[model samples]
Target: MRDLVAAFGGELPGCDTPGLLGWLDAFSDEHWNFRGRLGGAERDRVRVELPPRLAAAGLAAAAALGLAGSGEPAHREYTHLLILGGLARSCLQRADHAARLAGALRVGGIAALGSLRPLSAEERALPGLGRCRTEADALAAGVRAAFGGRAVPVLVAPPGDPAAHRANTADTYEFWAAGAHPGPGDRILVVTSPIYVPFQHCDAIRILGLRYRCGIDTVGFDPRLAHPPQPGGAAAADRCLQEIRSAIRAARALLAAVG
Candidate 1:
């Protein structure tokens, strides 16, 4: 963890877990959250040109933190399987992973949650989702393609402020939890890309797990196992850095909520 902190120009404070999370979040927000504005640009869409040493450090840190997919959940049964939405290709990849897990695990139901953010022209033209217009639509289409006619619930949340930003992970999780109302004994498994697992997992814990008193386990789609094969390069390292910043912020939120 300390190595990861140093990799991103952060210093791990000598403190308990909560204090460390707060420090990391503060540092990340000040130094690493690089988006121009709320929805004006996205973390993944940002083009990065990192120094070779920095890129290598970022990738190593990500792997140490399990941001490079664990490939399996901790348990074989879950009351709900939630696939978090993202970029067009990521939506399909994560949905495919979720479907594979659902087949082998005892899952009660499945839900793909996304925001109402409008899809870009490039995203709309993606295969298997040519007719889709929004992130939610992409996720729903992915589920359809991966599950092969299986009926799965798709939830979409309007942006908190349409003029500023798109609906985020918290909004989607809140929307689903409020509707599904999982019990204390139930467990939910969340699926997304490896880079996003840390932050999204923390978000799920803050919203669904804490509020509904249900267990939440978040995992990522293994890039090595992806059907079309996820491309690799320095860009992946940059994305991991972005998501590590995201995780720092979300961890702070989770700690505050726990308090």
Candidate 2:
């Protein structure tokens, strides 16, 4: 809590900052584990805040996953990184990290990618991306270039209306899921920004469990989680709360076609 306060400041709106500090100091693991522990909704409810929300979402996901990694692979694991993308400016970073993860993990399709948020005219004019009319195109080009257009094929999801983006996300997810052919016991990892982990995890678990009867693992790449700035990590992940909320809402739609 002190770290959070220090990272930001002692002043937080609607929060009894000092009192919250004391509350944190007094809170324990017992209280943490209590599922009934809840709080009332606050007033004002302005949604302009993004960074802290992302951070909070990441913390929620980490708690959901518990404190554990499968450890470095002894030989190879089915574990793969599913990257949710955002803008074109982030393509290079996300691509590089995906490559690094592929080098380390026995992933099937190398990487599955998506990001439809368009880049500004100025960003499009940048070298190597001048031809891309939208951010997803730039990301696909950047990711392919990261591997020198080698065997690493990046499945870039098509960008469009809210319904289209949701459909595209599910399509790309199914592509990777089928390509990997995960069985009942196999584990798949959903990789993206920390803020995205909860919603994406919800999508993956609900969809896969319904379709394949398989449990999966999810990880978020955040500055707090990854120090080296990797794809699916904060440096590469997009801060798209709108997209996040949409993804969550669509989790039901994703499974509606199924049983």
Candidate 3:
């Protein structure tokens, strides 16, 4: 947290003010589990503050990603990052806002995403579903046209529900079937829950660790556990943090190679 604050090279909002970190820390301590640790009230606190913090950090990290690789300082005011959760509406909403900010980038600019899964056409049809689907599709299409190819090289991993996941996977397959190659510099990452693997053909897990040169780490917490619970939750969070760091490093390497 302190490192994040220092990265901004300025005071963080509510950082020095009394009870801010204390409140956030308290919330984290309370709701760190999944079963029943966090009740309605504590959950509300996380829903409110966590989004903004993640968005801010994601944007900054993305800019840093670009800068470290291309030496072209990111000029955009915002970065696009996506976050998707199995049943978390708040996470999706925050992701929607972040995607909007990222779309403001100029041509050749980067769109850094942190998503549970790529948006489906069904989700796109919903009112106010946001730009993840739209922008991603557009970018893919643009890359294809530029390369003059009949299809793009995409790897899909469908959801757990065989039928629904298959449908979604098929839709993406069809899209890519008609898409052109996305040039060397263009890239996309679609992250999903451990259980969801819609596309049976693609080794999504392997792609994360080897192909895209990155992987996601997750830590599960049961909310029913006691406050400041045993070592389980922290261990998970640590694993997640480590995996995220590894992914950042991998992404940086990819960007550098392209540059």
Candidate 4:
């Protein structure tokens, strides 16, 4: 925790993991969590824009926190490889990464998980994805592209009430488990974007590992290897900051669940 704070050149006197997580969560809430109080235009107006030096600092902090990795799984075999979904491009990228892993690792099965979240205009317009109307559709397309003749299940969670809330990481995990019924002896590997590793890994641990007693390992897809590639810049710093907040919230929830 101290190392992470120091990476951003910040000091927090004597704080443990939860303490530091809470501090960071509050900081992000103040600066970045602009959902409830700010409308779209107002949120855009109030969004924090990092300069080059601060952007570099954010990147450093993210790397220190394990949010910049595209690491390999610890084992060569698993009961299943679970690919978590995101935006149209992210669904594609993560699925493609999972396909590559399948060739090297012995897995009982592979599944791509997504929410029923509808695609945005920009997502629909991304090259080769015009037909996708929902997140699951893009995931299916990606799995098909990457794992040619292989049969991979593409699972979608239903939308939450007040549709804006959307189905999230936990929801997808729950949906997949209810159908797959993986046993306690099973080991599941998860694939997601590098920036989301910490938060999503926490969710998988809390939901799948704790409940089913199944082992959970999550890794991020290397953007350098992603098809179409992920963009980087000052915006990357903002994303890292946003996901740091996500990791904090997820950790808090996991603690509460365990307790």
Candidate 2 per-residue lDDT over residues 229-250, each given as its tens digit: 3334322112232333334344
In angstroms, the error of model 2 at 28 is 26
Off by over 4 Å in 4: 1-20, 34-48, 160-164, 233-235
lDDT of 1 by residue, 138-240 (tens): 8888888899979987888766565746788998888887788888999999998877888999999999888889998998877788744575541377677
Query: Could you tell me every candidate's TM-score relative to the true structure?
Result: 0.90, 0.53, 0.24, 0.88
User: Once model 3 is optimally superposed onto the true structure by TM-score, how far is the C-alpha of residue 161 displaced, in angstroms?
Assistant: 12
Pairs clashing in candidate 4?
Answer: none
TM-score of 1: 0.90
CA lDDT of each prediction against the hidden true structure: 0.81, 0.49, 0.31, 0.81
Clashing residue pairs, candidate 2?
A: 221-233
Better of 1 and 4 by TM-score: 1
lDDT of 4: 0.81
Q: Which numbered prediction scores highest in TM-score against the true structure?
A: 1
Q: Model 1 clash pairs?
A: none
Which regions of candidate 1 are displaced past 4 Å? 7-10, 15-19, 36-40, 161-164, 232-235
Better of 3 and 4 by lDDT: 4
| Candidate 4 lDDT for residue 112 | 93
